[model samples]
Target: MSYTKTQTNPTPFPLVKVGMGHLKIATAGSVDDGKSTLIGRLLYDTKSLTTDKLKAIEEKSKQRGFDYLDFSLATDGLIAEREQGITIDVAHIYFSTPAKSFIIADSPGHVEYTRNMVTGASNAQASIILVDARNGVIEQTYRHFFINNLLRIKEVIVAVNKMDLVNFSEEKFQTIKNEINYLATKSDFEAQKITFIPISALNGDNVVEKSTKMSWYQGETLLDYLENIDTTLTNDSANARFPIQTVIRPKTAEYHDFRAYAGKIYGGDFSVGDPVLVLPSLTKSTIKNIYFFDQEFDTALSGSSVSITLTNDVNVSRGDMIVKIDEIPTIAKELEATICWMDKEPLQNAQKYYLKHGVNDVQAKITHLSTILKTDFSGVEENTTALTLNQIGDIQIKVSKPLFFDTYKKHKYNGAFILINPKTNNTVGVGFIKSPL
Candidate 1:
């Protein structure tokens, strides 16, 4: 997408602030789906590509005997990727306009790299799923969309790419759109807000600006939509959850008797004098002060890393949670969750593993394996005894101690956990809490 010098926005977009101005987006699709090319196009159009990098892409494209500059050369950073012509790891491409900065996660497309796709895009606020206009909506397309749905991404831009290959046929674009819409109805999950756009990333059509070849598309360009999309709200809950990471106490004689609980606040906001409850002990207290370094503030919102001091001398320790009295989460030892197996070893019944939930680590045992969820988001397969690599399933887990958590549907951060193999110490699977069992 190239913005010619002539065409410019009269009412410019807002300038990005230091902390809140940028957006994180993840791109996913099957091999040869133009994920890298789309990213390269965005970088090029926005003038984010350095001269050396652009020269490198040009040289690489020439070496491959290509007539046009292959934008995919910009993102295939790994030697293996260049040799195999497939993405193996998540390549983060950074670009910025005057209005905002964007971080695009170019995730792997192969079936075996599904774990990388999940971990790379888990924190992204939005996603772009590339569909080959020739292939339309294939299995990998369904898998990519299904994973995006599982991640609870609020906004999805389905780019129907390679329109030039199909002679810019509106009929082909509409057919792909209909198939996707029909496939969306097969799942019970609430499909996210989907916006379809037709583009030819190679020729820079409908990327940064409208394509003259296809005047049929009436929607905004990809960059325009991203600039205007609402990313303020996410999948995380609105209630505040402050999990104590550590305690800070001053031993110096300058002005002794200083103690603060330091942790990053998730969700909601906390203000001085707010009624708060300490977890496990269930002690009641009021917030006395909130501090960032030497400065003190009246309140701190979600995503703030500040030290908090309570009114009374409360016995709070690491791994304990502090939340609003009325916003206390469920405390339990057993939970039902959707599990994504990431390791080569299969997850079996009664398998012992170490579970890591936020700042706390505890022993966990898989009590039962439920059903294998098809990647296509079709129903489930019963009598599934093991969850293999790259498979999504449901299971029951019993932790060593009661955990203060919420369902993943309600609180994303508090509701997810990782299972580490005790023997290998490798992260074997990630679980999204469904409910307390």
Candidate 2:
């Protein structure tokens, strides 16, 4: 089964930038899909690895009696991972090219570690899903793509790896590409952009340099694409949302009257004189000032950790949210959400848990068990009674206090929450708010 070259769009070589900004990337694929090797290749070919690291890899590779360097050793950091030759936890690798700095999260591929993959990919602006050229599209590939779509990661690169093992065949790459494209049509996120690239990570083909073996392929190397892709687009462009983490008060003589709310801006920007409303209390006030450390600023953008003072001294404390007057989020006690169960214990109806949404922690209980969703793009199972580990499902939850939140699609930071088991204090599930119920 093969697809024609015209079936996939040809990627034009991107012009390299001198100094691009930072990018966070998460990798996903089944076990032995060469994910770690691809990352190691990126570091080695880009001259990002230090001398000591290279020497250690060479020594280890030789001791193992391998002809080529065991590039997977660069990212398989844990002893368990190295011994088993599989990633158990998310391994973060930081490297820089002349054009950009990258933080790659090497997520585990085993079925039991699906929660780890979700955590690794939650903050990524882009993702790279590796598919073994010899093994086409598999079940794990579907789960990876689904999670990326669920997280609203706009950019995805499907790197068909291990071309060397398959004799650098273009047909193999096309088959996998077609399978993934078909799956994309079933995805809820229609705007997700996917690019297909054929590469052999072990042999350094099409990773950092153009591959002569597959001359029929026409696309920028993996590094070239990473260097040129934009990382500025984020959910921060949505309505302004600031969740107060702490109330700062300097009772000292010089700044006796200063009462500022401190937290990182999650979405949109805030400026002096902007009308804002404090949540739960519903008190209104205008922004009096913004401060980052000891410095003062007229405006603070999203992701900025700054202290803000309101024109009126409305009583505010930790876990309180502030939002723009015009773009207020939903304030409700009951809501419906999609959740990924992460704990060993199954999720049951009317189960009590501590729901931590951003900086706010509230007592919450699952009131109703909805449908359990299939991760392979298959339709949902209706009337699901319970949710087990690695299972995703929809459910109705009632919180002790009103929550200020938006749908996950509308605002990433403000729309997510974690369910902590009251008795064990362990994160049992992660949820994305769907709507007020």
- Write down the TM-score of every candidate: 0.95, 0.94
The CA lDDT at 184 in model 2 is 89
Candidate 2: residue pairs that collide: none
Whose lDDT is greatest here? 2
Which regions of candidate 2 fall more than 4 Å away from where they truly are?
1-20, 234-236
What local distance difference test score does each model get?
0.87, 0.88
In angstroms, the error of model 2 at 215 is 1.5
Local accuracy of candidate 2 as per-residue lDDT tens digits, 1-437: 11112325322222235344778999998998989889998878766678899999999999999999999999899898789889899888987754567889889888888899899999888899999999999999999998998888888999999999999998898889899999988877877889998999998888888888999899887877887777776343688899999999989999998899999998799999999999989999999999999799999988889999999989999999889999889999999999999999999999999999999999999999979989988879988789999899999999999999999998999999999999999999999999998
lDDT of predicted model 2: 0.88
Candidate 1, residue 344: CA error in Å?
A: 0.4
RMSD of 1: 2.4
